[model samples]
Target: MKCLSMLAAALAVAGSVQAAEVQVAVAANFTAPMRKIAPMFEADTGHKAVLSFGSTGKFYTQIVNGAPFGVLLAADDATPARLEREGLGGSRFTYAVGRLVLWSRQAELVDAHGAVLKAGKFERLAVADPKLAPYGAAAYETLTKLGLLDTLRPKLVQGENIGQAYQFAATGNAQLGFVALSQVQADGKLKEGSAWIVPLSMHTPIRQDAILLAKAKDNKAAAAFMQYLRIDKVRAVMRAYGYEH
Candidate 1:
């Protein structure tokens, strides 16, 4: 009888040490990379990552309202900084730096140097909502720097987020769009579209930041996943998705 009792206690302790599942709120631009990384993280640490992808602005509002998120991978550093300032997040760090690109599914529509923007050949151009997405704001900045914002205003079609903006161009709703470099690139090459990699000097850096939410301060799984992101193998996956860590 004592042996059985001891076995029971051991089983309970082992169960208590089992890994946990973490809820991660991710920016849309990082969706692809996170999808690839989540499985690897789980395999390496026995922790499952549950991901939710959307605009950083929207995720901020949700987190402020207690969305039960363990961590946030934001599209911009400012959002994470704001969360830290509000005491909603703890221990923030930069995870990746994003690059913007002007892309089109149609062949020969977008030029290598982005001269196509000056020509104004398209009837409509897609861009994310500048107020809600950092990539959109960067797109605006790029157009303004090129003296094309005013010229292109009439033809602009605003998407709620960069993903939708890319969709607009992909599905033929708009001829071209400003999107994340990862969206159109695979294995260090263009996937199937023409793209003009935007110059870094044209706009401010899109330095993406990650933070552990206050709600997850005591969650071991959350801490493990955050640490996983900093590992060299995980960073390689991020780079494969066109992010600079």
Candidate 2:
């Protein structure tokens, strides 16, 4: 029947569409903005995104072990560069740069005018585990550059990743922590907290990059996501969430 033939053709097209989903391993720092951008991507391209968020280091380790991710959004370029060098990723591109902040759950604890370090009022501090999270490396560099590393080191609790570092402060387990700016964006506003945006000059640039994995080299959906990252609307959304293009 003609009607049956038309229905069969429609079903075939649907199957092809379903097969185009891209699985993305995203750094935890980018999770918030990625969430906001993925729907726009889907709307524009008719492809779905499957995302997993964790420390970039951990994600790199997993990818090396065959984690089946089609793309990687890393907090630093080194991971993507490594993937490219290893033939695991076909191409590399800078997506956005991350900004670090000193954040505390308590208003009086962090010092609005940025005198907390000078006052040394807090007995506990938290940072991401430097071995795991890129933000931790930036935090260490910042403190070291300020000549505060030795003094602050004694008061530190290390979280496994930036998310965990934020948790440490949110749960009051640590008085303060270093976190990504994206984590604080809620309802188009920064979260209620006392925060000092760490000067970028204090540390190495957090040059985040995204890559299309080898397994996804031929995947249209995966490539589409990369192009989506460069779109002006997506950049606008990323900027609103404190990402630097």
lDDT winner among the candidates? Answer: 1
Clashing residue pairs in candidate 2 (N, C-alpha, C atoms within 3 angstroms)? none
Please report, in order, the local distance difference test score of every candidate based on alpha carbons: 0.89, 0.83
Residue lDDT tens for model 2, 109-226: 6765456875778877889988888899999998888888898788999989998898888898998888998887654566777888888898999999999998898887887777
Summed backbone clashes in each candidate are: 0, 0
lDDT of 2 at 25: 94
Total clashes in model 2, counting residue pairs 3 or more apart in sequence or in different chains:
0
lDDT of 1 by residue, 1-245 (tens): 45544543443343357888889999888888888988877766667899999999999999999999999999999999999999998788999999999999987889899999999989999999989899999999999999999999999999988888988999999999999998988678788878899999999999999999999998878887777777766777888878896
- Give candidate 1 misplaced runs (Cα > 4 Å): 1-17
Q: By summed lDDT, which 10 consecutive residues of candidate 2 come out lowest?
A: 4-13
